[model samples]
Target: MRAVHHLRGAAAAAALTLLAVSGCAEKDGGGGSGAIQVTASDSACKVSRTEFPAGHVKLAVENKGSKVTEVYIYAPGDRIVTERENIGPGTKADITAEVKAGSYEIACKPGMKGDGIRQKVTATGQGSAKPQDPRLDRSVAEYRKYVQAQADETLPKAEKFAAAVKAGDIEGAKKTYAVSRVGWERTEPVAESFGDIDPKVDVREDGLEQGQTWTGWHRLEKALWTDKKIGAAEKKLADQLITDLKDWQKRVGTAEINATSMANGAKELLDEVATGKVTGEEERYSHTDLVDFHANVEGAHKSYELLRPVAAERDPALAAELDKQFKALFTLLDKYREKGSPDGFAAYDTVGKDDRKELSDAVNALAEPLSKLAAAVAS
Candidate 1:
């Protein structure tokens, strides 16, 4: 239950960050035609044109206020078609969207409230403007090279730290671990791209002094470095950390290269719960499984943000599909909170076998879609 609680909190934090950056795209003006103008003042959300010519349309969002803001454009049925992230104070970003003839909503998170400010917009008549493909032609190659170097160089240091521990060189292990951890942190941006990699193997968890550190190699470090007896029990624990390190390295190769796939996979996972295929514990108990689930989703979304431009550039249709998946995921997560677990912590074990199996199946269904999406992006 404790583990689960930790993970849920971490997941929430991660999701907020990823969503802020990944989907924010301004609609471009269709072939020099007049574009809709959206302006956000320090106190209000305003759009110059609520109705526009159908086909290709550009949205120019201006943030004249002194705060960071986000704007989201939604089609009918509350479907978000495009978004602008982190529109700094006194700056503007142009987002281009191909608005088919339909009704839409313009949502602005002036302060990133749980519920954002939403307005209705409509498009009518024949329009045929397409969003320019994102510039992935050069960045994709650079990102791939970056990931490869991280795996080749950073993974070995982790291995060295494990070796130091195995040989009973406590001080040496600590030194190596510190160096390795720093390297891993440097690669955090890229590492977030992979679904299989775990930062706990390399990064130190925070709040150790307050018993708040929950995951990562730091968990092992707490056990190893504490002034406890160094008996067979301690040795066994140390061995487990070493094994985990090796296992993590092997899994690194399986990480998806494309960000959109990672994000889509996360979205699919959340959608499963939304559709009622998966059921979590009745109570808000902290469990390792729950924690891992949250962490996995958060990590996946982070990766998606980094590679979003690539996805938009390479395949706009795919990008749109991915956004659909994300909306579903978020909706499902909101439902999970609303439905609050009935049993709480005790429900984890008391649940019937059939129920457990159903839940497990649901989770896997979510994972499966993500895996397929990731594979597509990597390919």
Candidate 2:
């Protein structure tokens, strides 16, 4: 029994290592030359073939520009599968995905934001690969791991920041808060995509930049950071931040739907925007939506921090390990916050498409660390 368990563990580790090397894994079907050619350009995305036989189809994506790009495959029922990472300009990578007979959209985006070039694809004839089960898919698992990492890595430090503020240690609060921002920024790419979703319905869209109104928490950031006064208003602002942070932490743990719902919601909104069904002005209500999304994630982080004390009580050794991972995540978020300027909108505007792509890449970078933390915490 022990020997069998050891072998199984080794096989799982080997499989994971293979996944890391290939970036994507082959799902089904024997080897063949049946591959779809995909090309990325500065202004558009193109695919040599739109239709393919239903089965395990390999997509060879070639990036022909000066910037890195991401190719996303969206199938029926809003299923998104990604083959992403740094694909340097003038380079190429091949992704093998199990595709079934259905309508699909292949999108290539320079950055994760703005408009991406999309080509529609359809599959006909019989195929071996079956329709993907949404609940148990790898993408969903990846997303969950990402979210949990954000929570575990950043939340506690944010709570410490809040505690410092409450104790009138403003400088300490700022320094501690800086640590939490790193993890937050690490996850920003995935978070920003949430902006493309419907503003009113999705909680993630609370801090968008293109909207007419501004009601999200970042409105407070503008007030606190931009304002000259360091008086009562600052204190009030700090208090509000603390309050919101606490509330967010409480809600995120119990929330049933999770971040995946927000991602699906954003994809739907993006599709609507693409079809000319949803105008930008109508879709982007304000920068508040973006702020709200950040707040939501930050709240989750706070909840994760609160678990630290409990974790320590249960297992001090494990808690120490978790603290290190959390610290790294916090450092990343703080660095991201510092990289941007005081004028938030201007900072966002000044970022080029390539820079945005880097931001998205950074988001993907958090997956492994996050997955490790999530597995450790699993009951």
Candidate 3:
């Protein structure tokens, strides 16, 4: 897994070379209002323009693909400036991102996996010269602190989980697995921005690219529970997990964060819940989906709360709707918790069809309004 990390970084560099060789055209500036258009099909990603003045940029993405898609604005070295994931087939989403004047790639992942198809574009003419609102600035500052705190808290728990794995204590490792992930789940987007850490630590089995060794929590998860044994390979992966997480911890403060990204990140958490946690795919072995489900909601709620001051000022109706939806979702999630145990929820497999539908509906309700948050705060 340690070697796998460096290899992925090399692959990103290779992808950059391919982007340049493929003739990514340049344009100075020319586009109208109402969000930059991005068409995502199975085989192609077409952006409306190759360049634009970039202060607060919005990409209006419509997926024409048969598979679900994800869109990202990545700076060089594959740093994610901002991204919108889980854009289902034939659906549309608006991604509002704050970009400084620089070179970037607008990448579309048709199946919501891999590095994605890249289209090189530049942001021109002093893109972020306009000073932001003071409230927005506070939101960014508080959120940055929150991200650092989550990272700080996550590392210790992950270390404990790793210790259990290395000791060949399967039950001990299993007990700490989901708990270790809560901090990471809460602030995943911030960790993911570093470009290379996420795949090493969080990439699921199906999410792996060709020849990419399956590592991180899920890999160890299968070992402790499904495989029912811990070998040298599992022990090595345990150490690698900590190594990757420690890297994330040290770099959390340095992440490129802004007001819109915070708003977008909150929404991304909901998308994470919708696609992975809610689907029962994220913890296929441990059946700890609800723990992750709670953490994702907590993270999303924190981001929304931090940004609420400005978001409410911009669109009070939207803000009110979000407050209501968030409360409703929490209320629904609480019903599943074991008596007297705040963190314990019924294993996902034991969750009936009706209950799962209720949870899914609540997420959808919150997600629809949450999606508009970036625009509200950006305005």
Q: Give the top-scoring candidate (TM-score).
A: 3
Task: Give the lDDT of residue 229 in candidate 1.
Answer: 25
Q: How does model 2 fare in lDDT? A: 0.42
- Name the best candidate (by lDDT): 3
Q: Give candidate 1's whole-model lDDT.
A: 0.47
Estimate the overall C-alpha local distance difference test score of candidate 3. 0.74
lDDT of model 1 at residue 18?
21
Report clash pairs, candidate 3: none
Q: Tell me the tens digit of each residue's lDDT in model 2 across 41-106.
A: 777788889887876666777788777776766544333433344556787766654454677778
Arranged by lDDT with the best first, the candidates are 3, 1, 2
Better of 2 and 3 by lDDT: 3
Q: Residue by residue across 75-134, what tens digits does model 3's lDDT show? A: 677655455666788777665455566788899998876778989998787655566799
Off by over 4 Å in 2: 1-32, 53-55, 65-70, 74-89, 98-103, 110-113, 122-157, 160-172, 182-209, 212-379
lDDT of each: 0.47, 0.42, 0.74
The true-structure Cα RMSD of candidate 3 reads 6.1
Model 1: residue 132 alpha-carbon error in angstroms: 12
